[model samples]
Target: MVAGRSGNTQLVAALDRKASALGLYVGQPLANARAMVPALRVVAEDAPADAKLLARIADWCDRYTPFVALDPPRGLLLDVSGVGHLFDGEQALLDRIRAELRRQGFAVRGAMASTALAARALARHRDGCVVAPGDESKAVAPLPIEALDLDEPATHAFRRAGLKTIGQAAGRKRAELTARFGSRLVYMIDTALARANAPISPRRPLPDYRAERNFAEPVATEDIIRQTLLALAGALSELLEKRGEGARRLEAVFFRADGIVRRIAVEAGAPLREPNAMVRLFHEKLAALADPLDPGFGFDLIRLCADRIGRAEAEAQQLDSDAGRERELRLLVDRLAARFGRDRILAFHPCDTNIPEHAFALLPAQHAGPAERPWKKLRGAKEAPRRPLRLFARPERLGLLRAVDGRYHMRWRNTQRLLTRIEGPERIAMEWWRSAEPTRDYYRVEDENGRRFWLCRDAQSGQWSVQGGFA
Candidate 1:
């Protein structure tokens, strides 16, 4: 019997009696569904919630095998090659999954076969059928052609021509089928019969090394978690060393008693296989978390995965005496970033431009280094007319008293600062496509006290402002 809710008494009674209740054959529209039964309740589909539930199910299915991927929108594809025997055969494994999902309040159907196509067909059309390794064709043969997940138009076309069962389609010559229905139908049939292979691509790639620890009791203290993480890092380092590789990224997952998983990821500048370094990096990251690690009742499981691996590289120690000074500088920057945020620490890199304002760019100190002269070979690579070491994030405007011979004198911050020298009034035209266009004539000037400043005159308004200062 088809155990599903329906508004129409005729369709529901027909489905209950197992009398060809093709869900596709109902031919009732939503408006019609409501007209048939005024008391019928309809609900919108919750796709995201369904997807998250499927992901949780896939994680639970990891006990069966590590190779599990979502069949998308619905269903899951599990690679149960050599692992099925551990559960006492494919049927037992399928039964186990079905029972477990049922216990978890899910209405599930399962099928096991030598190929994914056969399994998908059997699961959708013949739920109870279990196709042995070499008997995929025989198992799929009795099922309807619609089991192939064909489009509605194609299904209707096939049905109109009296080709219903897969066995009937299989009886026809491959050349005839391809000529009549196109290559897609032929390909689907071939794949379902195991004559062609269909592979499943996982959403997430498998990690290189995975280590898990299930605690007898939950622990929430940072000290204990750090110690446990150190141990896991040591074990992971050993694995990488044996493989002659190093991990570029490490992910630590803490599975709490409440069933929520918290993940922390660490990325290394270089591939790393040092246990202490890995633990230290994670410790630094953990110390920066805003939320307290409440561990609630306690964490049940802790899993560490090395995601990206690369060939291990050997480093040679520098003989220069300045090595210690470099290390001290790095340590200072790391501490400042840890406390004040990495954005607060900045480095400057030269840009390819003659304009003083565009001569350099600011970048995060953690990811940027001192500007180098590697591009010295490029034409016009020389530094532009000396720019101020300190530039305001934005130019501050000042009300000028007067323009003496095209030289403006101004008062800023309630202090009198004179523009002693002036250079060419270099006009920068605006890109009109974008709004707020500005035309400015810039000048390099020095105050009486030998302080150099970069000032610009707004040509349109005849207003002057100090853009930057040389420290």
Candidate 2:
């Protein structure tokens, strides 16, 4: 099965052993492939899904080493330097990884070297290779120049100069190579030979506290997994308390046997140190997943980590119940956020704008606590014009408004009513420097039925609209 953009129908990207034996090669046109074998089948390319699967595979590789990085398109880089001895040596670890993936039904190739570039090149080009420390150059010398991953023009120049193998290119003078092909070729050769260096960026942030469990046999039941999480959370809580900090965000990673990884993340509305609270939050997060987690063939390793932390300290007992009430409220917020999503639970924060519509903004509850930004009181008046309990998102237009000798009469919702009382002519001007907007004179008017409405009249147009109503 394969895909390409040569035509609308399809093109070959890969083929099975039978197809290869019958002379079908990758990048061969689909029309040509079908002609070769009438029974050939082709499928559409799902690049995004493939990329996601690749990411999951990278997550699973964390079981081997925390320093796993993506190599893009379809590859991964694992920095197994200090960790390889855990499996009894680099060779044993590589063999174990290969055997596990193969058992999970994937065709895998692996190689190890002192440098990431050399290891990646060998994995893609050579097979079953182990370039011992200080021997990277000798091992990759015989491989083709393509292993350097040079641009096509540079590769063609190298070929034209009769430098076909990496060894031949290595033999040339560095200054001479730079003069002919620019500094890129020189730098690439140095990197491939482990003479130059680069770094691998891990997919996730390194945690402050990490506790992991590796099983002799894979564990599949959800209850058992929860029990593991409970234990890890207990250990993590103790660590956080000793450090005088609390976890604000935590991540639980399950490494399945079949190269699939499932991750559950939970965030706390306030700094959280209780292990039981953390466990409950994770349960809510896992239950809210749109796709139920499946432990296919079971998980071989599970790790718990505190991804985000914050300073926390024990507070003195309050004379009143205010502190207890605040704690309870934050706990409720955390639970609701875990179930309904963080964005779904929000708190209003004041914005630096006078216009009612632009006066405030909503932020996630976990991000914007009640005290994050204090509410600003209107200037000048001790008893300001009472704002409606509920303000309209946009003011509703009124059909007819008339003032009868200081008293008001208005037609609203197909009914005419005489306003018994009127309180304001609060004038608010638009920020003229920002935009051209009409100034408004707002009035609190009470109708015959005693229902009070906030009405705004455009000073320029003399048109009135009902903005909101008091409770």
Candidate 3:
């Protein structure tokens, strides 16, 4: 049994069959529950761990069908509509799912119907009910009003009006229900009667293209897994080639026999259509996994999916080596990114900002799109760089010292350096649309030891500071 805080008081959150038989229901106040059974065993509820376990269970359901959605706290919805025949029939598919999950020690209860809401109601009330086509209305007609899963106020209103069963409440006119208990109750009735369909949002996006291999017997050998991956990648490549499209993001899903699903994803710098390249990325990703993929009892199923895709236009055979070199560079970036991480390998993309710190943005090279603007050069090609190589986040103030014949002089870093030369005072104004900022007069000055320093003077405050350094 589990107990947690609900409002200002601790309440019973969950309990097993034995607790249920003992008349300790969920949502009962903790004090009352303890009084009812003096020796009742209760443990604190860990919501995070429970949610994670539910998510893992949803991942495990992917082998049965890709259209799996979570139904919070303790329920899962699987849209196995057209895929039911693969597991023999609808009844067999449901039975197999229940049997497998029960074998793994999960209290399973599920149902199937035309609408998601109808199935949800049945799963909660009828448990193992399977409503045939055009039978949703009849199947859910006998369930109590609580099966509709309405709010407390709405449920009480229905009960007060002597509406006990779902059939009784659904019998009322739609306009009356909408005007009284509100549209939610009306919609629930509509869906329970199969007059409307409620869509279930899948936990993950549907892949554009997919290939899978299901084994009759679980295989644990390393060579066998490698061969299976290559085979699946080849099959997926053929499909991509037929459509003249390549994948930028690819994911490989491994379903372990013990209901554990391992998913590995890799991204390419450009559209990749070659099977060898795709498999190579997966190999690098697997090798870099901190927690190595454990094949407990081997994997019964392996699936490869192209999550993001782009056009794979045929490139003309080039006579020069430049094109080949470009392709090799892209492949290298992809491999390195897979081994390390996508964010670890980045490229500078120009931003449309005059501020030195905001001039360029470092984005992941593997998935970064083209930048909008080009990098503006401060000096002409072949000329000395006008901007400093290193810029400080915040300029450090410099103290001025009266100079005579040696030209400009300043006290910086607890030392005074004699300035040999000073360049033009480049005036820069802040953007008007942004917050008000003072104008700056920048100067490129060379010190006595041939070191250059970037200095800026505030026009408003008449203050001098070092902004950057070239040495």
Candidate 3, superposed: residue stretches over 4 Å from native: 160-162, 216-223, 316-321, 350-362, 367-383, 390-417, 461-465, 469-471
**CA lDDT, candidate 2, residue 62:** 88
lDDT of 2 at 422: 82
Per-model C-alpha lDDT, please? Answer: 0.73, 0.83, 0.88
User: In model 1, what is the error at residue 9, expressed in angstroms?
Assistant: 18
TM-score of 1: 0.73
The residue-level lDDT of candidate 1 at 261 comes to: 61
The RMSD (Cα, Å) of candidate 3 is: 3.2
lDDT of 3 by residue, 1-471 (tens): 899998899999999999989999988999999999999898999999999999999999999888999988888989998987998989889888888999999999988888888988898988777889899889988889988878888889889999999998888888888899878778878888799878889999999999999999998887888889889889999999899999899999999998889999999989888888899998999899999888899999999999999998866645558987777778899999999998899988988877665677789887677787776898888988888988888899997666866477878999999888788698888777885888878888898999899999889998999999985
TM-score of 2: 0.85
Candidate 1 vs candidate 2, lDDT winner: 2
Per-residue alpha-carbon lDDT of model 2 for 185-304, expressed as tens digits? 787787778888777788877787778898989999988999998998999989988989999999988888777888788999778888888999989888988997799999889999
Q: lDDT per residue, candidate 1, 1-471, as tens digits?
A: 212234643332112212233232243454555565555544544567768978877776655665788987678999888977877987888998888778866778889887887899999977756788789888898889889888898888778879898878888888988897899888888889988887877656778897777788888887888888988999999999888888877888787755556777766544678777777767776777787556887787777889998897554445455864664455455545544567777877777654556667888776676677443322255744455678888898866665657665667879876667656576766645544647778777776677777778888888888898866
Clashes of each: 0, 0, 0
- Candidate rank order under TM-score: 3, 2, 1
lDDT of 3: 0.88
